[model samples]
Target: MQQPPPPIFPIFRSRITCAVLTHTYVGDKEHSITALAAATGTDSGTMAREVSRLERAGILASRHVGRTKLVRANHAAPFYGPLRDLVTIILGPAQVLSEELADVEGIEEAAIFGSWAARIHGESGPTPVDIDLLIIGRPDRDDLYDAAARAKSRLGREVNAVVVTRSRWEANKDGFIRELHSRPVVAVPLPHGNAA
Candidate 1:
């Protein structure tokens, strides 16, 4: 399943599109309600109920695959483009970047630190123009650069990725690492794994 970077909007504000677009942009083409729930940080029961509502509104469509039902975005819906743009362009980079990086082999752990993180943590400042990432592990530098480039293009913001060896990260020896840990840090989950 495609993993969406977490939504920036209050979950309650855009819960419907948050759930649907996470599936549309970052999710697998079709997601079981349970998977969608987990992806959107919503409980399974709530996701099911919301999906039912979207289906009624024609924003999403579902089909039965045996006893399980899979839901996906209905591109044919009139609001699809606008809604997708809202998530993909305005409110989706963090979610998308986190999800995309999670799939990169050798990227064991990742976190966001900097202005974006500060804003999320309720610090006031000029809007952040870039996302600062602290990546832990020995991922291919070229691959990491490529991913950051793509994300930058898509989000219209810089994605600065800093790599640190696991040993250094664990030891907390570097002053930069120490300072980073002191700030707001939002952990990004690795694929099929807990937040790292």
Candidate 2:
């Protein structure tokens, strides 16, 4: 007779499950229970119980590496893709914003700038909480403002941005655009009509 599947975990447990999977699959690292507990902000006892449950469900494997037991994803685990997607969602706006801007039109290049850019470039005191976009495009000022508004609505916070036409950008070559590109950039390609 076929054995019944394990019971589904609660939403909180689902988050912990996704975190464990990310460390195992995408991170591609073996983790001790203590490390997994710390990463997920859960207690060691809870982590142990969860790991044992996952192991029984055949989604994870454990091996004794010296005195420590190392945990990793089972290569044949069925939940790998869904688990990865959940992690992407939990990691928040920086990754999502980058993905969305990659589809915007008329933008030749886009980067996060200002204080955030400085921090990313390792020249800063602290990282800015909000995203700052520097866009190279020919978008009208009103259109750019509307886009920023929409992004703010979707992200639940102001998305500080500057959109400069290619001509204006080139003319002010020694200014913000040049300084932005001088730093380590997280570039996203915009659609052709949107190119600045």
Candidate 3:
């Protein structure tokens, strides 16, 4: 007889674990399981089941508040610190890239922007797209282009970069792109800061 496939709840649990760890602080503060389910694109029932599983594993704490059940991170959880550290380390490259670009003459600041920034901020889903950079500078046109090309070569991935003069960035400070340009960052260094 053919065996039925393993329940889909476990798959949802695993996916939610990564998403929540990467996007939420998960300590003391309460979070709605429904919201978490929406964030992870999983159904509420599956999220509730997985939440119970995680609770048993000491990764989460749950309580009923009014008509809603609020779930939160248990600071006493063994994997809390390690999971947080993992997310930081994984996101560090974007910061390193920003710092590297900031070193170029005429560049004032550089940041991972657009969809990449949204993903980092937990406002959107991850995409298999090139990293987008918002660079503030007034370098010579050739220098700007060359810098981006070199960054792509050194990083082993194509960087979709947009370079704007400091003045332009300042003038358009309220714009969406400018907002992304100033978002929070993570830093990562090359094997040695080498352009190779």
The best candidate in terms of TM-score: 1
In model 3, what lDDT does residue 8 have? 19
Decreasing lDDT order of the candidates: 1, 2, 3
Model 2 lDDT at residue 45:
87
Model 3 lDDT tens row, 1-196: 2122212111223445654543344222577889888866778887788778878888777789898998876667777776544433343335336444544556555566655555555453555255677666554556656766765654445677676766676687667756654674322222322221
Q: In candidate 1, which residue ranges exceed 4 Å CA deviation?
A: 1-20, 98-105, 118-127, 191-196
TM-score of each: 0.74, 0.44, 0.42
Q: Model 1, 1-196: lDDT tens per residue?
A: 3233333444423544554565655443788988887776777887788788888888788899998998888878888776666556545656767766765777878888887777555566776778888888888888888888887876778899999988998898789989987898767656754323
Count backbone overlaps in model 1.
Answer: 2
Cα distance off (Å), candidate 2, residue 78: 17
lDDT of 2 by residue, 1-196 (tens): 2122112222434556755665665445689999999976788888898899989988788999788889987766777666555443332234445445644556676766655445433453543556678777654556666666665554555677777777777776666667765665544434455453
The top-ranked prediction according to lDDT is 1
Candidate 1, which ten residues in sequence have the lowest lDDT sum?
1-10
Predict model 2's lDDT versus the native: 0.61
What overall lDDT, based on C-alpha atoms, would model 1 receive against the true structure? 0.72
- When summed lDDT is taken over every stretch of 10 residues in candidate 2, the lowest stretch is 1-10
